[model samples]
Target: MTTLRIILGDQLSTTISSLHDIDKHNDLILMCEVNEEAQYVKHHKKKIAFIFSAMRHFAEGLKKKKYNLLYTKLTDKENTGSFKGEVKKTIRQHHINHIIITHPGEHRVLEDIQSWETDLNVSLEIREDNRFICSTDEFTKWVKNRKQPRMEHFYRHMRKQKTVLMDDDKPIGGKWNYDTDNRKPPKSNLTIPKPCSQKPDQITKEVISLVNEKFKDHLGELDGFDLAITRDQALKALENFLSKRMPSFGDYQDAMLEGEPWMYHSHISTYLNAGLLLPMECVKAAEDAYLNGSAPMNAAEGFIRQILGWREYIRGIYWLKMPGYADMNFFNATRPLPSFYWTAKTDMNCLKQSISETKKNAYAHHIQRLMILGNFALLTGIDPKQVSEWFLIVYTDAYEWVELPNVYGMALFADGGYLASKPYAAGGSYINKMSNYCKNCEYNVKKKTGADACPFNYLYWNFLAKNKKKLEKNHRLAMMYSTYERMDEKTKKQIKNDSLQFLENLT
Candidate 1:
């Protein structure tokens, strides 16, 4: 029987499960650039271009190997505009009766794929996506009977299981985590190295043109389109990070600068998520750097933990709690995300800088996402759906499996204490301590209230006071509530009035 294998754009690796049992003679690979996927969220223009270019590049690589392949361009006359439509068309044209697919990253896509068997009357075999170190079933098994499924515990499990950063069966540097050594804020004299980048080859140039013509209204520009689009380029990017940046990656992993966006970061997450680089390969590379005495243990362990631990754990949480999880609003937040998110017109320097960088690069480091933008959303009470959509639309690396939990659970705490023990909400002082953004702002970070005060200050307290009934019981926040209770009645009233007035003025 002839088989039609469906490879989604994100599944660009040759090691993808669907391609493992290849029959060059009888199996035909079908890859489509559909409008439905691209237009799902007004995705960043660079993101669309990168994915399309990488898909085209991967298809070319397969063709060089003499595979039976059907590649669909977005402007193909016979293009069906949707994955299922394309699959049906391919089945009729090729007389294919069987379909093989790898499980998709998004739950919504999986539901549609699950329907294809009955809806199209075809034989469907969906294989497990083995690209990740931890399988969905493995994560489920790990969670069985566990009270709180946090990343820290799961990370340690992965470290030992994977034998990563292990010294005689023990974690290197005497601890499973080195976060205490890694939190030095960005200093004034810091010299940030830019990640390795390449000029767009002919294929990428064409893809950029296509994006310009088709998605001109998308969020980000094609200017400075320097991300790696192929596996070879992505490997170079990984090596470059280890040689030049990994040593300092942990120290400033959470730090932010006014104009500096790529401070000691690998910047390969886009490549990692797009399947150009395998997660294990990146993890091993960081581990090798530490053993070779190039990157310190704190840097290597921290970096490895992000890939092997947090990345896997987050994906686990996503699969474990999705479909119903997206609808959670633990804070019952209902405010519309203000227009300043799109325009970067806010007086707060941190928000303005984070949004402006997001508009330019379709990327922001974790702290900017968590403390600045996500923190503001949490503090000011933006609806989770709106915040989630904005994040999904903007980042080049944001697929729903990873992006959803990070934004919904880690960023907004919309899942409440289920995913995070405490809200990541913070005031201007935290930003002031961690970043130089507060230094250049119009509002004073030190001020507690008034017109010239940072909005985060009151918004932070307001979010706490407003959600006290739900959050005060949390052990992590006991001290915070005690501090709030210590304030005199007049001070509390002023805080209430300032918060109301500031939030009311938001548009």
Candidate 2:
């Protein structure tokens, strides 16, 4: 039987499950750059270029292995602009009767593909994606009877199951997490190692031009596009991080500097999420560095926890609660996102730096994403859907399965503590302690409620007062609520008025 094997843009791995037991001589490989996926959320121009370039490179490698392949470029005049349209045309043209595909990263894409068997009147096989250490069915089993599926508990299960950083059965160094030791603030004279960069080759350059022409109005710039487009380059990037930056990655993982965007960061999420690098490979590289005395145990454990713990746990929660999870609005926030998020025209130095860096590199470290940009949206009551969509659009590594839970549950607390123990809301003091943006900010971080006061100070208090009914009983936020309650009535009124005025004039 003639079969058509389909590959999604993010499924660029050669070991992807859909390619298993393939009859390379008779089976046809199909890859397409369709407008429906690219423009689904007005994705960053660099994001589009990276996926297309990587897809082209992956297709070339398959062609060299003598596989019969059908590829569609975005610029083709006959492009149908949607996956269904392209697949229908291909099935009719090739006289194919069977189709096989790896599961997609996004839930919506998976739903569409599930409908294809009936819609096209062909047998379709959607193989399980084994790229992750924990499969969806496995995660569902893990969380089946638990009241709260905490990441820390799930992380320990993963470590034990994968045997990562384990000494026989117990965790190495007698601890499963090093997050506490990883929270040091940045030093004034901190010396950061430079991350590895790959210049665009002919294929990547062609893809860049294509993105610039077609997505001129997209969210990000295409210049300085230095991501790895293949597995070889991605492996090199992993090696560079291990040798040069892994020693101090734990210490400064949460620190943000004024002009430093990639400070001690791996910058490998784009490659990892794109399937150029496997999560276990990166984990083992860090573990090897620790075993050889090149990197500390804290650094290795910290990095591993992100992938083996948080990344896996979030994916599980996304699959478990999705289709209903997307509509969660715990605080009923309905405010529109301000124009400054796109333009980076805010007087708040923290927001300006984070957004500007995001536009330039299509990346921001975890701290910048959570404490700075995400914190502002949470404090200001911007719609969680708008915040989630913004994150999905602007980042090179963002997909709905990962980005939605982070934005809605962890960032916005829109899921009411499903994904996080508490809302990550903070005032300017937290930013002042961890980052240098406060030094140059026009709004004073010290002032609490006045014309020159930092917006976060009053907004933080205002958020607490506004949500007292829903959040007051939670033990994690009891201390914050007590402080709010102790403040004099007159002082509380001043803070509320000032926060209201600041939010009113935000646009």
Candidate 3:
């Protein structure tokens, strides 16, 4: 009756039901650091350090609870650097007859495990990942016959089903979304909330050294990295957000400021993505803050939607259409990502700031991701797969399942109208409206066709022109084209020429 349990880095949940009834004497738990995961993309140094440190911390916690454990450090010399290789070696050494695992976050990893079952003569059983509020089956049931799986509709249903922010089974404040109230532009005198940070412990310091030695060529800085790795530390991060930050989260969640890394952001995504903090716990914490009159309803509801609505909905969409989902490219874009994306050396002030911050901290708020980097990629027609891979690697909060849908589907609109009704293509005005980065830009945000014209303006029109045949059928996109039709031919030709010049320089 010998068994082995495999725990992936992202599946470090202590409450996972897979570990419920432990025959610890007969069963061994296996955890490994695989290069296949890191090499999938050139991940930021901070991201690599974070996952490794968190995994090591979780392993230590499990040992303190007296579980039979087999953990691999990144520096383990004999490691084969692949999950299957490590698992096979463990099975032979331990004489394990069966292996149990929680379902992986990505389908590729799941398929890899499935491919090995017949050869090993061992049963590989995968339990559900219960950290999510809704199960895959539940989401599938909700989308059974729907022609389109729009997230807002699904979000409303989730609200009703879970009774989150409900009054007598009806939505509180009589509205399904308070998004309109959450989009205020940043003002000159706004008071910014201080971000939460956990001081590095001995284990995290070792992980930093491991990353420095092993991944010296990676993209980001390792010197300024510090994140919560333990449950108590994670709880404190949650508390600080509730008490100090959540009240202003809605006011400026969409607004970007200069020299500010965290303006009313929770900074809890790292913990939540790492399994150190559960999403439901965060949702409840926000709800309690609203109920106690410690935070405004707009801020509470907005923060809750990001978790219970957006985070949950994206996970469902990712699982529903994957394996082939990564290849979706509606625009047929073949361009490589601009070199400035990696270097952060551009005259466009917004992009420069966002990318420099990404290089510094290996983190950016959701708006920065969607609007700055993702927007530029979408408008410029960069390869969807490359853009998606960049997103998967750059951030500490990224895992394939969460990162893919947001990057490919929501941000890039590469899913060809599956996750969104239309591409979120926009002219420079949208960026100007959202942030102060445009104020200091060399290119004028108002102009579209001259040398001093903003790149977003020309590229946006060019994007629409290039993809009109594909997008014309979408009702939401039809009006934009109709407006383009009214523009003089002279102006249209100038936009095309400017766009071509910009594309030429992109490479």
Candidate 4:
């Protein structure tokens, strides 16, 4: 029987499970740059270019391995623009009798794959995606009978199971997390090492041209498009981070600096999410770094936790509660996202800095995403669906599985604290402490209520007050509510009025 193995854009790794049993000379390896995936949410132009270039490179690698491949470019006239349409076309052309596909990363895509057996009249084998440390079945089993699936507990389980950061059955240094040690504020004159970049190869240049012509009106410009497209380049990036950035990375992982977008960051999320870098590979390298004394324990452990712990847990929560999880809106926040999010025209300096960097580079570290842009969206009551799409559209590292839980649960608390224990709401004071954004702001960070006051200050309190009924019982938020309650009646009213005026004026 003729067999066709389909590889999705994110499944660019040769080690991907679907390719394991392939008959190199007979079975056709099919890869397509379909229109439907690219235009799903008007993804950033650079993201389109990045994925397309990487896909093309991966296809070339397959051909080099003597694998019979059917690669479909986007501009091909026979391209049908949808995965199903392309698959049907391929079946007709090749007269394939059977198909094999690794499970996709998104629910909608998975739902579409479910119909292939009935719709195409072919035997379909959907292989388990073994790239993830936690499979869907594994996560489902782990979540059983648990009221709240906490990431820390899950992290510890993964640590013990994988033997990562462990010393003879116990966690290394008697701790599974060094997150507390990783939160040092940005120190003055901190000279951060910049991340490594790769110049565009011919394949990438062609893809960039295609994205420029096809997705001109997309979120970001591809002017200086630079990212590792192949596995070797991705490994180089890992080495660069270990040697240059990893030492300071743990110290200021949470700290943000004005004009320094790549401060002590791995900048490897795009690579990791794309399958160019495997999770355990990155985790092991960091572990090796600490073992050899090239990097500190906190630095290595913090990096390992993000990939082995949080990244895996986020994927688990996504699969565990999806389809319905996307629709959840616990607070029923209905405010429209302001245009400034798109144009980065906001008067709030922190928002402007974060959004501007996002628009330029399709990136912002976790703090900027959580404490600044996301905090604003939550405080201003922007619709969760709208905010989620904005994040998906603007970030190169964002896939539905990873992005959804972060936005719905971690950022907006829209899933009723399913993924996070409490809402990640924060006022301007937090931003001022972590970043230099407040130094040049037009609005005073210290002011709580007025036109000249930082909007986050009043909006933070206003969010707590508005959601008092829903969040009052949350133990984590008790102190915030107590602080809000201690304010005099007049102060409360002024805060309400100021928040109303500020939100009303937002456009």
Off by over 4 Å in 2: none
Clashes of 2: 0
lDDT of 2 at 27: 95
Off-target runs (Cα >4 Å) in candidate 1 are: none
lDDT values, one for every candidate = 0.91, 0.92, 0.87, 0.91
Candidate 4, residues 1-507: lDDT per residue as tens digits? 689999999999999999997788789989999999999999998889989999999999988888999999999998999999999998989999999999898999999998988999889999988899988898898889989999998888889999998888999899878888998889878878777999999999999989989988888899888899999999999999999999877889999988888899898999989899999999999999999999998899889989988999999998888899999999998999999999999788999999999999999999999989889999999999999999999999989999999999999999998888999999988898898889999999999998899989999999999999999999999999999899999999999999989888984
Better of 1 and 3 by lDDT: 1
- Judged by whole-model lDDT over C-alpha atoms, candidate 3 comes out at 0.87
Please give the distance, in angstroms, between residue 65's alpha carbon in candidate 3 and its true position after superposition.
0.9
lDDT, candidate 2, residue 116?
Answer: 86
- Candidate 2 achieves a global lDDT of 0.92
Candidate that beats the other on lDDT, 2 or 3, i.e. the better one: 2
Error of 2 at 360 (Å): 0.5
lDDT of 3 by residue, 1-507 (tens): 588988898887888756767687878999999888877778999888888988998999989989999998766887889998898888888887888888889988999889768867788788888899999999999889998989899888988888899997788888878899999988867888677777898999998998898889889878867688787788899999999989999988898887887889998888898788999999988998999999998999999999999999999999999888888887787889888888999999999999999888888998889888988999888898888888887888888899999989988898888898888777888889988888899999999889999899988888888888888888988888999989999999999999998889888
Best by the lDDT measure: 2
Compare candidates 2 and 4 on lDDT and give the better one. Answer: 2
RMSD (CA, angstroms), candidate 2 = 0.9
Residue 349, candidate 1: Cα error in Å is 0.7
RMSDs, each prediction?
0.8, 0.9, 1.3, 0.9
Query: Against the correct fold, how does model 4 do in TM-score?
Result: 0.99
Q: Which 10-residue window of candidate 1 scores lowest in summed lDDT?
A: 412-421
